[model samples]
Target: MEQKDQLLQKVWLWSLLFFLVAAFTGFVYRWGLIGGDILGLRMSNVRHAHSHLMFFNWVTPVPLVFMARHLMKTAPEAYSSLKWCITVIILIGFASYPFFLIYGYHPVQIGTANLPFSVMLSGLVMIGWYWFGLIYLKYRNKADSSLSQLFYDGALVMLVVSSLGAWGVAVAQFGNIDNNLISGALTHFFLTTFTEGWCVLAAIGIFYDLSKKNYSLPVDKNWLIAPIVLGAPLMFPFGLSVDLLNESLLWTAKFGSLLVGIGLGINLWYMARALPSRNKVIWLFVLAMLALKVTIQLSAVFLPETLWLGQHGLRVLYLHLMLLGFVSTLFFAAFHTVNTRSSKAGVYLFLGSVFVLIATLVLISGLWPPAWQPTNVYRWVTVGAILPSIAIAVELVVAGYSRFKQG
Candidate 1:
């Protein structure tokens, strides 16, 4: 058991290092988008690099560490496979994806088979997910079939499912297919399942896992499961770029938003009661941002025009709410659990959270129909985005120098 804890501790540490890069990429992405020239590259390229590295690299793998806790308990072999898979995630997600940034969209060919860098990375992800999914299935029925586990299971399935869409993307790109609908559906399918299923559900599961320990808070399994599982899939229409006219898709999108709202709403109620007493301000800040994300997301269903908001400034903001606000915050909580901390760490985390929150507000304010955005708002957003990077740097240093402690 001690060995397992120690192994998981290193896993979180490695995950955080990759997250540090993801945070750095966030600053670069925002800086590039806001008209700054750092690498003499277009914002789109930076955005691609940022999103791929952050989402596939940091967001997916980090959560696996948390999920592994349960895997270790029931299926040690699965946990063993997961450890190696994480190592590969670090290679592809951290090492290779960043390499893609350095060499953007340039696909190498072997025997007339053209391969996009993303396509290659996607292959790696599929391989990782195969191992992950198989590992989970090994003792899934033997494991607890609670809401948290349900989300974890769903997320595992989605990872494999999204990889199929990813392969479709590769096929389209390689075939030089210019058909918008084909590519768009493939892209949307991958993104929707990944973001909603893997990212959001995993974060929700982590929250439930954390909440289990709090005497003041009790998790309602049904509340966590129903809306997210049922409603989250509906939310994917937002990712579709091809068809906004289909009545069925439109209504499904709206209903999905509502269900996601209720699910997250239930989460906030329980988390609110539990976090404060634990002095988990970081968790509080993240859960609050999640509320904002769902509210804004679902609002698009009611105020259909709000769908246009993503065109303005909400795209990156929405992504951040899920990536940093929901996903990374949970990782931070886990990191704090693994490592002993000093007062300086708390201050760093608090200030970092404040900056990130302020940045979100600033970005939301920058949305169209209300353009009184703060002058040089990008600079403030950079500070907010980079602050966490700096905080993580400190934490990484502390973790590296400090001895392992009990969870």
Candidate 2:
């Protein structure tokens, strides 16, 4: 049992390494696209690959593994199946994503739905999470009552819900619904639910667990759960109706964002009190970046023109803000606090975050006109991007080596 546990730990850690490599490659390719060309790689292919690997392979695996570890501890009898389920999800993600990158969005038809290789893998993951849900439902009574646990439960549910976006595309093929708005909205639905719902919930749960373990900040599972849980899923309707402009959905989006803002503000307040012992600067930056992420998400309701940005190139900037600025930073904090291992990579993480932010800012600034910017701003943005890539690359190596050394 002990050996198997250690092996599982290694698999999860190695997944992080793979995520770093894939993310670095993706960002570099993105910069290359901006800078006219890098090695003549196909931009679409790289973008497809980058998003798949980052979304499927890297982001969820980390939190899933951590959450599974906790579940197994509380319900030892279910350990064997839980372990296998997670391993299978990881393997399927690792195997399937490269094909998507190479094949573009090729989702084959089967009955009422298209079954792309990527979507198939996602289906398998959804199965894994179903078992996860079962574990929770069957054994939750054995666990203590806490908000963290509720958040974790919500995270698992959201993870399962998030996969439907891919399946919806498959379903659309059969339904003969091929309009770009509806299709794009569905895709956005998945990304938003996964990021704002599953990822955010897991981060909160893990953050709470870390703080409780430290026994310093008396973390409470307060009424804030109301807002967070209520808000996260409500705005998902926004994605389905993004272009249609329904009055009900528009108002729902506004209300949902308000609830989310309140939930997030509460979390931020508690987190700020706990910040001194955290990798203070990095965590605070994460909070700020998270605020920015929420603001961007809600911008469509506030400034209707914002809805158009997703189809525009601005979508890339939005994704980078969430993936790099918010999700990744909080992920590191979760690992740091949960494992109680002090790492020297905070500086790298912080600097890399700043570089990525600056690159986004510069790129979005529209290069501001030829005379005022003189030098090609896209080229400069690419240059700034190199810092984060290098810093993150180093941070990956440091994290992997340290974990390996400990094992």
Candidate 3:
């Protein structure tokens, strides 16, 4: 049983590695080293590959694997089938990344073929998440009353909703064959729903669960349910009405963001009070989370059209801060904390990665001008990339060693 758990953990870790690599490639492309034309299909292909790999293969799967192992501890009979479902989901998600890369390069011709692969992959993920959600719900109902149980239940629902939103995107791509408007609507729906609803909420749930493992605190019932209760009404209308994507939709997303941010703030404050005064790593993680929440608020207000930053650059920077700086860093910290033999090393790795990530975003968003000065921008980005890669590599090695020693 321990061996099986270790194997699953490795799979989850490798998925994170893949996500980091994909994210780095995206940063490189954004900096204009790899792709020649910013507007060309090749750039689009790379972006597509980056998005799927980061979200599906990297972010979503890691939490799924962690939750699955937890489930196996109590409900061993369900383990085999859940593991199989995860394997299928990962394989399909992996296969789709290359297809996205190809489609990006040959947008007009290869996209047709690529769309089917994406559809199939999205379908598989939805099914896998459904199974996982059912398992979580079953476990939550049976488990002892705890904050972790609440988080598990909440994350499962977010996962299912996110998967369904992804499927909506796949369907919208099909809509593109006839009308670009419908396709655009679906794409927007997918982005907002997945990012705000599933990705962010699930990350919070994981953080909540990890916090409970370390200290006892009352779960904020409002924060736990705010994303779904608010996000659903905000996102559901997007599928049915194309007009919601215009300007009015911003209010809903902003409101949801405010609620989530307040909730996170309360939780983090509680966590800080609970932690020992010497834990700088946890403090850094909390600050990163606050930064992310602030970034989300900025994006909600200025995205697709900020005065100084422009729409394109602001969107990219917003995503970078939230995903790498906020979500990924917290996850790295939590993982290191749980597996404490290398906790110090893990904190170093996480902090180093975050510093590089922030530097990269600042250069990309603050330095670049519309007139095209690529020399200094590329150099700084290249330098920024090195820190995080080395940090994450050290983290992976140390984590592997710690796990092995335990075995």
TM-score comparison, 1 vs 2, better candidate: 1
Ordered list by lDDT, greatest first: 1, 2, 3
Order of candidate numbers by TM-score, starting with the best:
1, 2, 3
Better of 1 and 3 by TM-score: 1
What 10-residue stretch in candidate 1 is worst by lDDT?
A: 338-347
lDDT values, one for every candidate: 0.68, 0.66, 0.61
Steric clash pairs (candidate 2): none
Candidate 2 lDDT over 35-135, as tens digits, reads 65546666776777777777766777777666666665666676666667667767776776666665555675669986667656756766766766776
Q: TM-scores for all candidates? A: 0.85, 0.82, 0.80
lDDT (tens digit, per residue) of candidate 1 on 1-407: 35455666777667667767767876787676667787676566666777777776678777777777766766665656677877776677655565467666667665888656665775776787687676667767766765567678767766776777778888898799998777877787778767876788887776665564434325556656677667766666666653443667667777877887777787677667656334376666677778778777767767755446336456556766676666676666655644445234733564466456556544655454445666776577666766777777877766655544433
Clashes (backbone N, CA, C under 3 Å), per candidate, total 0, 0, 2
Itemize residue pairs with steric clashes in candidate 3.
41-104, 45-104
What number of backbone clashes does candidate 3 have, counting pairs of residues 3 or more apart or in separate chains? Answer: 2
Worst 10 residues of 2 by lDDT: 210-219
Candidate 3 stretches with Cα past 4 Å from truth are 1-8, 31-41, 105-115, 176-181, 212-220, 227-229, 232-245, 275-283, 295-310, 343-347, 366-375, 404-407
